[model samples]
Target: MPDRKKIAVIVAGGSGLRMGSTIPKQFMEIGGKPVLHHTINAFRHAYPDIRIVLVIPEAHSAYIAPLLVSFDAPPSITIVHGGETRFHSVKNGLATITEPAVVFVHDGVRALISPELVRRCCEGALAKGNAIPAIEVKDSLREVDDEGNLAVDRSRFRIIQTPQTFLSEQLLPAFGQPYDPLFTDEASVAERFGAEIHLVEGEERNIKITRPLDLAIAEVLLATNK
Candidate 1:
C-alpha cells in the first residue's frame, strides 16, 4: 500500500439552502474554522501525502484561495468545478485520477471525521477493494409507502458515513457508468458496478454538519477532543 497513492475526492457542492445561509454550508465557520478546513485536515492528519480533489461550484471558486490561506492549507489540493448533481460532481473529480490508487470520496461538510476512522477506511479498502464506514441505526424506524406505514426493524439497517474509500481500479470505472438518482454515494456507485461493499466501524461523532444544531454538536466534540 505504500507504493500506491491515496486520493480524496471531496464533494462540497451543497447550496446551503437547508442551512438558511448565504454562504455554502461547507464554508461556514465551525470550531473557529470552516467546515471544509476541518474536513481536509482530517484526511491530512490520517495520511499527509494523500492528494485532494475538491469539487465545488464554479461560482464559489473564489472562496477557496482565501479559505486555504486562512488555515494555511496544503497547496496539493486540486480544485474542480462541480456538476449538476452529486453523481456528476463525483465523476468530474474522478477524472483527475489517471492512475490506480486508493480513493476516498467524502462529504466536505462532515467536519468531524477523525484520523482513526479515515485510517480504518483506507485499510479496509486496501484489503477488500472497497470500504464504506457506517454505524448501527439506534432510532426506531418505519417503512412508508402508498400503504400505511409500518414498523420496521431498525437493527437491520445501518446509517452510512464517509470517507467511502475504494481502490482506484474499482472506483474510477464505477463512475464511468451512467448517472442514476440511486447513486447517493461512492459505495452505491461501486456496488452497482459489481464491487463488493465492505463496512468498517465508524465513529458516532463523525456526523455531517447540515444544520445549526449540527454545528453546535461539532463545537462540543472539538472542544472535548482538544
Candidate 2:
C-alpha cells in the first residue's frame, strides 16, 4: 500500500518574465481554470488523503486565497510564501510538511501532469530514496555556447520533469545547505547531497506552460485528454 499521508509541494514562484506576462504563469488560465489549480487538482484526485503545500509569491497570497473558491479546491491546501528563487521556494514548501512520508515537488505550470503519473512518482519514491520523472531525449541533442555555438556530445542527455518525488526524511535535510543559484530543481539539491535518484518514464504530454504558444497546445492536449 502507498503512504496515505504523502505530501506534495507545488512551486509557483516564478515571475513569468520569460512568458512576458504581468502575472505569474501559474495564475494564468488553462482550459477555463488557473494552471496552478489544475496542477493541485491532479494530486488531490490521485491521492485524496495526501497533504498539499502551495508555494506562491508572498504578495499574491491574499489575492489567491479568495480565488481558491472559484476553483472549488479543498480547504486542506496550505499556502506558503515563496522565496526569491525556485530552490528557496521549494525549501519553504518542504519546511511545512511535518510527517514521515513521501513528498512530491511539482511545477505549478505543468498542469498536464496526470494523476496516474503522480501516483507512480509517489510509489517510486517510497520504494527508492529519490525518484525523478524523465523522458528519453528522442531528438539529437546539442550543447550551445553563450554565442549560440554548438559543442560537445549529446548522446547522454535526457529531459527531466516533475513531480520529482523523495522520501521526506531524505529530502528535508538536503535543503539545510546554503542555497546555490545553479540548483534548478529538487533533484539537483538531492544530488548535491549525494542522494541516488531513480528515473521513471515521463509522459510526453506533460509539458510546462512557459510560452504563449504553449497555452494553445495545452488547450488542445486538455481537449484530447477529456
Candidate 3:
C-alpha cells in the first residue's frame, strides 16, 4: 500500500478549574515534566515526520512558546488559540491543518498514551475515515436522572478516550456545524456528520488527568514505564 498521510493535533485548553489548580492541567508538572510535553513527546517518538498542531488558550500561548523552545520541539509544530470548549478548541486546531492527511486529535492530559496506540488509531482512521480509541466499561455504569436517580441500563456503555483519529476531509466539515454543549469530543462531532466511527481497543494507561489524585497515578505510571 502507499504511504499513509500524516498530521496530529493536541488540545490543551483545560482551565484547571476541576483540578482546583491555579495553572492549567496541561502545564502542571508530572514526574518533573509538563504533562503536555510528555504527551507530545510520545507522538514525536512514534512519528517523527508527522506535523503537530497544538491548541491552547490564547493567554497561554506566550507562556508555552518558551517551553517549546527549551524542548527543541519539532519545527513542524504550530500553535493556535483554543476555543471555549473541547469541541471548539478542536475546531480551532482543525482550521490550521491545511493538508488532506489523516489527523489524530488527542488530549494533552492523556500523557500516558502510547506511540503504538496513536499509530494504531491513525492507521485505522486512514482505512475507516474515523476512529477512536476506546475501552469497554468494566465498572457497573448507571444513568442518573436530574434528581440523582438511576435511569438506564448499565451493560450498554463504553468509556471513550482520545487520540481520536480522522481523515482531514471528513473532520473539517464536521466542525462547521453549529456548536453544542452536548458535543463532547471530535468523534461526537464527526458522528453527527454521519461519519462511520470505528473503535480501536485503547490502552488502560491512556488516562486523562482531571484531579490532583490523577497526577499521582500518572506519575506512578510514568515511573513504572521508565
TM-score (all chains, Cα) for each model: 0.96, 0.91, 0.91
User: lDDT by residue for model 2 over 1-226, one digit each (tens)?
Assistant: 4544789898887666777888777888878877877888889899888888888888777658644875654448888998878888898998887778889999888999999999899878878887899987777666677778674465577799999999988899999989988688889898898898799878898898989888889989988894
**Over the stretch 1-226, how does candidate 1's per-residue lDDT look in tens digits?**
5668999999998867888889889998877788898999999999999999999999998789767875664557899999999999999999999998999999998998999999999899989998899999998999999978999989889999999999899988888899889998888888899988999998899998998898888989988984
Model 3: per-residue Cα lDDT at residue 136? 79
After TM-score superposition, what is the CA distance of residue 2 in candidate 3 from its true location, in Å?
A: 3.6
- TM-score of candidate 2 versus the correct structure, residues matched by position: 0.91
Candidate 3, 1-226: lDDT as tens digits: 3576677789888877888988888988887878888898888888888888888888887658555764764356788888778888888888887767888999989999999998888878877887898887777656677778574665676789999898888999999999988788888888888988789889899999989899999999999994
The C-alpha lDDT values of all candidates are 0.89, 0.84, 0.84
lDDT, residue 22, model 1:
90
Spell out the clash pairs found in candidate 3: none
Off by over 4 Å in 1: none
Q: Against the true structure, whose lDDT is highest?
A: 1
Clashing residue pairs found in predicted model 1:
none
